[model samples]
Target: MFPKAHQYVNIHAHRLAISQDEWVLTNLFAGDDFPGANETAYYSTGLHPWHIKDADSEQLIKKVELAAENLKVLAIGETGLDKLIQTPLDLQLQVFGAQVEIAERRGLAVIIHAVRSYNELIEFAKVHQPAAAMIIHGFNGSFQIAEDLMKAGYYLSFGHRLLISDKLKDVVTHIPAEKIFLETDESEHGIRELYKVVSELRNISLESLKVMIGENVKQVLRIR
Candidate 1:
């Protein structure tokens, strides 16, 4: 039998300063410096759309390929289309596509950062049909978009926005528990606080919500 979910899981955090006992997935930019050598937190590496200008496209792809081989790396993004960012959409698509290919090849999940480009993303997913699980992190889109992605077999991860976005709370309450996840995503809010908000929103106990998300994490990361 699988172990029961007992701790908060932060799917995407810029810093690794959270409590030691919680399960966290930290983000590492492909072109940036690696995390501290002594840090033992699990990580997800990709070429963030905002940082593409600072990296050599070819070399960054290679680095992401190499990083995916590490056992400590659980997923392959924080990478995806961001319409609001200055990076060109075509370039972002190229980078995001390459990372998706790498995640599929490496048997790791992906965490996407989509902004105002859900149609393009959904189209890409339809064409590529990537085998690895794909999660849209920091999701705050309309319920129709959420429903579309979930129907397409993509997971939607909500973050601090749930605390204030009534629309997001409605989405959380209606979406299947198996198709959702929660995160802090660089917010000042603690995972425990997010958990409390989500529990109340979903009308479920905090422990039950933890177990539900924990199971999703295990499946996405292919944890044993």
Candidate 2:
């Protein structure tokens, strides 16, 4: 049988767990070395758009494909468009699309890293319509954008941005429990703190929020 859900589910994190209570889905950027055999944490692997210009993307994608064979590898990204970067949108699309294809083939969820490219991301989803759950990590968009993405059948994951962005707080309050997740996402803030903030915003008990997100991780991400 698969493991039961833990008290805290960090959907996207860069570091290993600081405590056993947290089930951290660590992000492994392609081209980086894989964790040691003794490592005991879930991971999402893909070619990050920012590193495409600096690395052999095809080789890195091959690495991702190999990594996906490991049951510890639960999702296919931290891969998506980033308009703020110098990487051409076309190249980003090509690379991101490749990773999405892997997720579709592997029956895994996708942890997306979008930046000022939601419209294009939505269009891409409409066209390809990947079966894997597309989770937009560290989402800081307006309610309308969130609604549109949800309407297109995507999930929103809030991280450190939830602490400072009033707009994001509003988004969290209304996002359906089943479609929402929380993460740390390379930030200094703790996942537990983010959970507390979200519980208050949604006017639900902290325990209830934890149970809901745990179930979402299992059902939406299909993690046993």
Candidate 3:
């Protein structure tokens, strides 16, 4: 979650954070400026689409390639299709497709963005057939869409919306532990609070669920 919303990272028994929360928080949209190595402490990289507009696409591509070479850059993207935004759909698709291609080449997992463009996103997935497992973050789609993606062997990430949706609870009930994750996304809800609800819904202790999530992060990110 972002500081502008909840305004703080409330660390608790929730260890779903494979790395420190602020590390994931601050650099979430740092884009090509995202760390390759850190002197303070190491942080993981998550490629985001929002910042793509600010940089030269060609230069960013090479920067991302270099970032991918770093062991710390674990995820290929928060990149994908979004139809609701003001940005041109064509450019979004170009950046999205390019990142997917680079991810496939680098053996990195992806954090995806899919807003009002599931059909197009699914089609891109068909062509890319990315080797990295993708986690569709902030998933608020219908049960059928979630089921469709699940069947495609992609993991799903949940965030603030889970605090509201009963339908999501039902959908979550059917998903296996290995494929399930909880994220703050751009939401204010603390990760600890998320675990409280998720642990209850999944019928597992908060500690156990956190462990499962940590393992999922490791497997998906291919982190040592």
TM-scores of all predicted structures: 0.93, 0.94, 0.80
lDDT top scorer:
2
| Best of the candidates, TM-score | 2
Worst 10 residues of 2 by lDDT: 1-10
Model 2, 1-224: lDDT tens digits are: 12245468889999887887788888999887876545677789898888887358889989998888777788998899999999899999999999999998888899999999999989998998888899999888999999999988899999998899999999999879999999998889999999999989989998888889988887756553
Error of 3 at 205 (Å): 1.4
Q: Per-residue alpha-carbon lDDT of model 1 for 1-224, expressed as tens digits? A: 12246778788888774665477788888976665434567789998888786358778888989888777777898899999988789989998998999999888999999899888888998988889899999999889999999877799998999889999988988999998887888899888888898888789998898899888877888642
Q: How well does model 1 score by local distance difference test?
A: 0.84
In the range 1-224, model 3's lDDT, one tens digit per residue, is 12222122221111224434332422344343555364332233444556667357667766777777766666666677778777788888888777777777877777777888777767766776767777787788878888778777678887788889998887777788888877776565777777788879889886677677766655666542
* Candidate 2: C-alpha RMSD after superposition: 1.7
Query: What are the clashing pairs of model 1?
Result: none
Q: What ranges in model 3 sit over 4 Å off?
A: 1-27, 30-32, 36-47, 52-55
Q: Which candidate, 1 or 2, has the higher TM-score? A: 2
Supply the global lDDT for candidate 3: 0.65
Descending-lDDT candidate ranking: 2, 1, 3
